[model samples]
Target: MRQGKVAEPVGAMVIPAQRGGVLFAVGGLNGELYVNGQALTGQWAEELRKHVPELSSDLDRLQAMRAEWLDSPPQDRTLALAGACTDRNCHTTH
Candidate 1:
């Protein structure tokens, strides 16, 4: 209930490869964001959003990638979509 504290485990999806440690939590207050116990400012979230849009379209792509990871072994194809995102202006065709 305190400010900047995440009290509950909402939902989490693990990214693959270099980003495998990322976590996502919905239904919680817009409190401080953290990955592996390090605190992050809201700006960090905003920056990530800019690179990876949270829109349903983008998420659908990620979901598909996750599904593909289940049977076939992970490949460069799975990482092509998001792994290439480096600049702040990187945008995926939706």
Candidate 2:
């Protein structure tokens, strides 16, 4: 009999939010938030509202905050995202 490769359990799931506008990391020991390839918000901050229809106030707030932050034109949005990932205590190796 042939044996199939055992599937490893996933520590987290990356969910698409807002038609792939953002990605959320859930089901891990620590929750994290990312946007446009950048980690700009935290999970505890309720940034997942962007995906929820009923509780969207937090999403609106995030948009407004992002707008203001972009007004200055971040020197490097990619770096910012990387920094956020690190700030959120996400392991890059995974």
Please give the CA lDDT of all the candidate structures: 0.35, 0.35
TM-score of each: 0.29, 0.28
Query: Mind sharing the TM-score for model 2?
Result: 0.28
| Candidate with the greatest TM-score versus the true structure | 1
Clashes of 2: 0
Question: What is the C-alpha local distance difference test score of candidate 1?
Answer: 0.35
What candidate 1 gets wrong by more than 4 Å, as runs, is 1-54, 77-79, 82-88, 91-94
Q: How do the residues 1-94 of candidate 2 rate in per-residue lDDT, one tens digit apiece?
A: 1112213211322323334333332211122222323334455235445444442443444444455454553543333333333224233224
Residue-by-residue lDDT tens digits, candidate 1, 18-78: 3222333222222222322233334444454454454323344444443444445233332
Q: Write down the RMSD of all candidates, one decimal each.
A: 12.9, 13.5
